[model samples]
Target: MKKYIIILSSVIIIIALGGIYMKHQYDERQEKNKTAESELYEKAKKRMTDYINANYEGIDKINFSNNYKMDQMGGINAEGYLNGDKSKEFWGIYDKSNNIITSSYVDAKEKPACKEKPCKY
Candidate 1:
């Protein structure tokens, strides 16, 4: 009976350790995924910024939404405000081709606009 009890306890300890290790591994994977996602977003933002700078020029104080629409054809659509004015909204579209991200932007017609200065980007 004593030998059986020792065996059972040892098995339980082994199972607990295994569970802990598995949990640690799962946590590490999640962290890695989050880091990768952050990096991707930064790169996308950079592409969008380049597009804005090349076309718009002389734009100050811009804000972009954290959430963007993604399509299966490797396109991403993003929305943002210009010159800290919510009414002055715009949309940017990014396409990925051959590992290169290209971007374009347009004024948001659906959203209402204000006659604010320094809001054209």
Candidate 2:
């Protein structure tokens, strides 16, 4: 009886260790995925900025009109002056140039506009 009890305890201990090891492996994989996603977003943001600078010259104070999601791609509509016109509108992709180059325009739910403080238009 004592020998059988000892064997059962040893088996339980081994199973527990195996479970812990699997849990650690799962956590590590999730961390790696998160890191990769973060890097991708950083790259996307930089690409978007560079494209805007190269294509849209003489435009300043550019702001994102909509919330950016990491899981999906979208576009942002910007309102700014071009050569002091103060009436030009720019609609382009969030982090890609293909949409802009192909002339794909996405309707922005909330358009960004220049505003002054104290309710001044």
Best by lDDT: 1
TM-score of 2: 0.52
lDDT of 2 by residue, 1-121 (tens): 9999999999999999999999999999999977765565455445444444544445454443333344244433332223334344444333343433222222222223311211111
lDDT of 1 at 48: 67
Tell me how far candidate 2 lies from the true structure as C-alpha RMSD in angstroms: 10.7
lDDT of each: 0.64, 0.47
Which TM-score value belongs to model 1? 0.67
RMSD of 1: 7.0
Tell me each candidate's RMSD, in Å, in order.
Answer: 7.0, 10.7
TM per prediction: 0.67, 0.52
Off-target runs (Cα >4 Å) in candidate 2 are 57-121
Model 2: per-residue Cα lDDT at residue 58? 55
Query: Whose TM-score is greatest here?
Result: 1
